[model samples]
Target: MVASIALPRLMRIGAGASRLLPEILGQLGLSRPFVVTDPYLVSSGRTDTLLERLASAGARGTIFSETVPDPTVASVEAALAALKAGDFDCVVGFGGGSPMDTAKAVAVLARHGGHMRDYKAPRLQDEPGLPIVAIPTTAGTGSEATRFTIVTDETSDEKMLCIGLAYLPVAALVDYELTLTKPKRLSADTGIDALTHAIEAYVSRKSNLFSDGLALQAMRLIAPNLRRVWTDPSDRAAREAMMLGATQAGIAFSNASVALVHGMSRPIGAHFHVAHGLSNAMLLPVVTAFSAPAAVARYAACARAM
Candidate 1:
């Protein structure tokens, strides 16, 4: 079957890829940018690391560090307020999924002038927003590479899954070095989330040759390295593999889509405030067991790939 594949316009991937953000922005012709990130990254000094790199190239930007774990409508609005307060040329989502998703929402809301709920599924937001350059600190979420973003509606307590090409980041800088310091639990959960993405992408109703190839490769990279990184956080090789696996899985799922596990996990995440990757890990085994019968060959392919 013919497949429709979507990806970041510019993907700079390597150990210290984020250091090239300035060059990437230059390529996109975007100068002044507002960085969207969470306070934890700021407290941990990771955000400063990115800023320093950008500053080395004489490109400094404002930061909006109010993004929360599970981004809510209120958080998006807060980011929009920060965005509007600046004369920025672009948005830089400079952390994990929450910040990236928040940046995507903020970019859209700031440009389109409406609530995030208006851009949720059933309403495809294909109209462009401010250009976004995603720099993911975690190996999971792959929000850096995807054309989808999730935001929770505080009043309804529902995680709104916003989809469309408009949400895709214009560029992605994937630096595995950023995840080298991740703790055991975060490494394990995000690794499992990446694994689930590969498996689900390979077996989804939307799967195609392009996605299948990426999914299998992602599984191959992730299966062996997941435990390695968890047990030995200082293992650079394992960490790099996990990082690439996550991005590959993100790309695979972005094009082919996720199925039962993701659908079930989102609601759980909204209600319990569990991290998105952890919630996906929680539902993976159970959901996979239930969905395998209908897609036995595909499931087996994933197993063999792993």
Candidate 2:
């Protein structure tokens, strides 16, 4: 089957990929960038490296570091206010899915001018947002490349999954070196999230030839290395492999579709405030086991692949 896929015009992956952010911005003629990240990245000095990179090129940036996990509408609002308050010429989404998603929201909303819910799932705002350079600290969600962002509605507790050309990053710097210091549980959760992406993409009713290959190779790379990296946090080889797999799986699922797991997990996350990835993880085994009977041959391949 045929499907639609969108991506960043620029994606830099591998070790030290982040170091090129300055060069990336320079080539694009972007000088004054507003950096969007969470306090965690700020405290951990992840934001510092990015700042240094910009400074190296004599570029200036203002920091907006209040983003929270599973970013909410309120959080995006705060970021948008900050963006407007600062005289930022461009934007940099720096961190994991939450902060990155928040950055995307800020970029889009700043230009588009409206409440987040005003641009919900059924709506696709094609207006280009501010130029956003994405630098992903975690490999999962592939928010750096995809055009989707889930921001929670505090009043209704709905995970408002937003889609549009406005959400796509203009550029991405995916450095595996960043994941080496991540704690084990986060590593496990995001790794499983990547696995879920691959599996869902492979089994999705919307699956296509292009996405199937990405999903297959994603599973091949991630399934083995997930545990290895989880067990030995400092395992560079495993860490690197898992990071690549996570990004690949992100590409796969974004091109195809994540079915029942995401559909059901979103509700659980809304109700229980369980981390989206954890909620998805807890449901995976049971959902797969129950659904395995529907396509025994394909599922057997999945089991073997895992």
Candidate 3:
């Protein structure tokens, strides 16, 4: 059997990875960027700091900070309109999953000119869109490394899972420093999310040798440190491990795909307005208990890895 894999073209990981955005952009030949983020990041001045750094590097950037959690089709449309309003060369996704998802959707819609639902699951958007550079503030979603994005349909109240290479970022800046300030609840939720991703990818029917390696490594990194980071948000070592684990888990699932936990968690998030990671965390234990019987060796491998 053959295994296929895809990942960000460029990745900068570590303490100051986010600070290398300008250089990363320059490497990609992108100067004018449409920066997409959430209001919290903007209000916290992280957005301003990034913009200032971009300016210092002679890269002009425009900011759109209206992205909401569990990004909506309407929000994506608004972001696309903003992207179209400027002469930007690429899209920069700054912050967590929502902003990244918004950027991915806008990038594709800017080139394809269609509704968010048009790119939903089972639709393979192989053609690249505007280049995306993701800077993830949270360690959980791994939106920075994955070739997938999720947006919600307001009209139907359904969470739209958009997949394909087009959604993958051209570059990802994985800086654990950014996650140091994240609250305990968020840390716990996102950690569980990454763990679930690793486990599901390992057990998935689509799992391959390449993805299996990543999944196991992700489990080894995430499981032991998840609690350490949650117990002490300022634990740099734990935070760093969690960040790397999340990205690896994302890469694993992106290549092999997620299984029952994710499939069941999405709707729960859409209907009850639960956080994506939190929903996944809630479903993981039950899903695993039921699934382990069928895949004893795989589950055992996961247990040993964790």
Candidate 4:
């Protein structure tokens, strides 16, 4: 069978790629942008720094910083309200997974005129939404690279997993410098999450040659560096490796797919309000152990790759 791979049209990856956000939007002819982010980034002043850089380029953006840890339909609607209130030309996702996912949702819902539930899998939304520029502040989740997003339904208490090229960012600006300030626990949890994405992508039934190469490379970059970043947050090299590994793992899984751990972990996150990466970390070992028997050789290959 032939495999289809989808990714952002433009990707800028390095220590300070985020500084190019204004240029990216200018190149895309998107003058008016609305930013979707979480309160933490706003409180920490990272959001302000980014806005300041954009202003220097003669671009000012409307900010919606109320995104929650587990983004909800309510939160998405709130963002949509912001999107509708302004004549924004594009959406900027400028924080971790939550803000990125929220931005993706707002981009789609604002155009299609529907609720988040209308686009949940197995709904394939290859049609485009508003142009989105994703700048991930965290090293994990890889939301900037992937063609997927997750938002929860408050009424039903379910994590609605949305898939398709529409959810993918039009452009991704991945800068490891944004992750230097991440706390130790967040560093550890998100590192494990990226590792799990690599392993599952390599082992999934949907795996193919291109995804295999990416997954293995992601594991190679993540395994040794994950611990280093957690122990010494100031280690620039380790942080860069982890950030690149996370993006690779995201590309791997976006082209392939995640297996049991992600499937099981989503429900846990929906019920308990756990962080997406932390929930993945909680279930990675147990789910891998249970599924290993069915694909021993594949699992062994992952072990050797790591």
Candidate 5:
């Protein structure tokens, strides 16, 4: 079977990586980017820091901090309305999966002048909307590099999985330094999410040579570093490794596609408002036990690795 792979055109990985945003945008020739993030980032004043960076780079932007954890179709529309009212030439996503996902959906629906449902799966959205610059503050979800966005539809109350070329980022700034203040709960959940991504990608029916390599490395890096980061939050090297592992897992799942856990987790996220990562964590053991019968070797390997 043929396979496909996609990721950001540019990536900057390291400590103090976020400080390169202005330079990165300049390199990409983007000005006047709309910032799509959450209230926490804004209330915490990381928003201002970003704005200051943009200003420093001679760029201008509108800050849209209204994205919800499970951003709804209504939320997408709200962001689109705001985008239409601005002269944004690019989009910047800063925060966890929620904000990053919101940025992606907004980039698509806003630019294409269509509803979020218009880009639903089994359909490949060929048009690339405004170029996106992702800065992930969490070491999970790997939303920074992937070309897939899991979004919620208010009409059906289902998390619509939008997959294809359009969801990819133009650039991703992965600075583990941003994870410094990540709460232990978020660290645990995101680590599990990354773990799920690696495991599912490894066992996916669509898994291939390229995705397998990425999945293997992701598993190796994430398996050890996840617990380390949890136990010692100040371990800079561990945090950095986890961050990279998450990104690698994102690449793995993006190319290989995720299976049952994601299939079921999306529903719980839509129905119960459990964060996607946490929901995946809750289901990991039970699902592993069930799928173990069918894919015993893969499950056993993961079990031993964990």
Candidate 6:
């Protein structure tokens, strides 16, 4: 069987890649961008700095900074309202996973005019939406590279998994510099999340040669450096490695699939409000132990790679 692979059309990865957002937008011929982010990034002045850069490059950007953790349907609808209020040509996801997921949901809704639940899993939305440019401030989630978004339905308390090419960002700016100021807890949590992504993708029954290569590489980059970054958040080399590894893990899982850990983790996240990565981290050890017998060589390979 042939494996189908999907990824951002353009990616800028490095120390200051986010600063080149205007350039990426220009390359895509998009001028007006609706920037979606959380309030913390806005209060931190990072959002203003990005908007300033965009303005300097002659791109008009509108901000929507109310995205919540886990990205509720109400929040996505609010963002969609803001998006529809403008003649924006693209959406810019300017923070971690929540903002990115919100941006993806809004982008699709802007074009398709539907509720978030309408795009849930088992319903593949292949049609493209407004272009999305993802600039991830954190080194986890890899939402920038994946064709998936999760939005919670507040009424139902369900974390709706939206899948399709429409949810994928057109361009991604992966910069390790953005992760420098992240706290130790965040570093550890997201770091383990990335490692879990790699391990799960490698052992998944849906794994393919291409995804296996990426997963192995991600594990190699993330495993040794995860603790180093946690120990010294200022370690540029470790941060850079972790950032790249996270993105690779994202691509790996997107192309292949995540296994039991993710399956078990999502409910914990939705029910108890545990952070996504922390939930994954909590479950990975036990999940791996239980799953190893079925994929012994695969688990062994993951151990060696890590």
Pairs in steric clash, model 4: none
Could you say which candidate leads in lDDT? Answer: 6
**Candidate 6 C-alpha lDDT tens digits along 1-306:** 899999999999999999999999999999999999999999999989999999999999999999998999999999998898889999999998999999999889999986889999999998999999999988889899999999998888788888999988999999999999999999988888889989999999999999999999999999999999989999999999999999999999999999999988888899999999999988998998899999999999999997
lDDT of each: 0.89, 0.86, 0.93, 0.91, 0.88, 0.93
For model 4, how does the per-residue alpha-carbon lDDT over 40-76 read when each residue is reduced to its tens digit?
A: 8899988888888888888888889989888989889
User: Candidate 1, residue 3: CA error in Å?
Assistant: 1.1
Cα lDDT tens digits, model 5, 77-161, are 8888888899988889999998898899888876787688878887788688888899999999998988888778877889998
Query: Candidate 5, 85: how far from true, in Å?
Result: 0.9
Q: Rank the candidates by lDDT, best first.
A: 6, 3, 4, 1, 5, 2
- When summed lDDT is taken over every stretch of 10 residues in candidate 1, the lowest stretch is 49-58
Q: Which regions of candidate 5 are displaced past 4 Å?
A: 303-306
Per-residue lDDT of model 2, residues 253-294, tens digit only? 778888888889988998899977799899998999888888
- Lowest lDDT sum, 10 consecutive residues, model 2, at 295-304
Q: List TM-score per model, in order.
A: 0.97, 0.96, 0.98, 0.97, 0.95, 0.99
Distance from true location, Cα of 243 in model 1, Å: 0.6
lDDT string for model 1 (170-260, tens) is 9999999999888898888888888989999999999889988989999999999999998999899998999999999999999999998
Instruction: Candidate 6: list runs displaced more than 4 Å.
Output: none
What TM-score would you give candidate 4 relative to the actual structure? Answer: 0.97
**lDDT digits (tens) for residues 163-189 of candidate 3:** 889999999999999999999998988
What stretches of model 2 exceed 4 Å from their correct place? none
Q: How close is candidate 5 to the true structure, as a TM-score?
A: 0.95
Candidate 3 residue-wise lDDT at 267: 93
Better of 2 and 6 by lDDT: 6
The parts of candidate 1 lying over 4 Å away from their true place are none
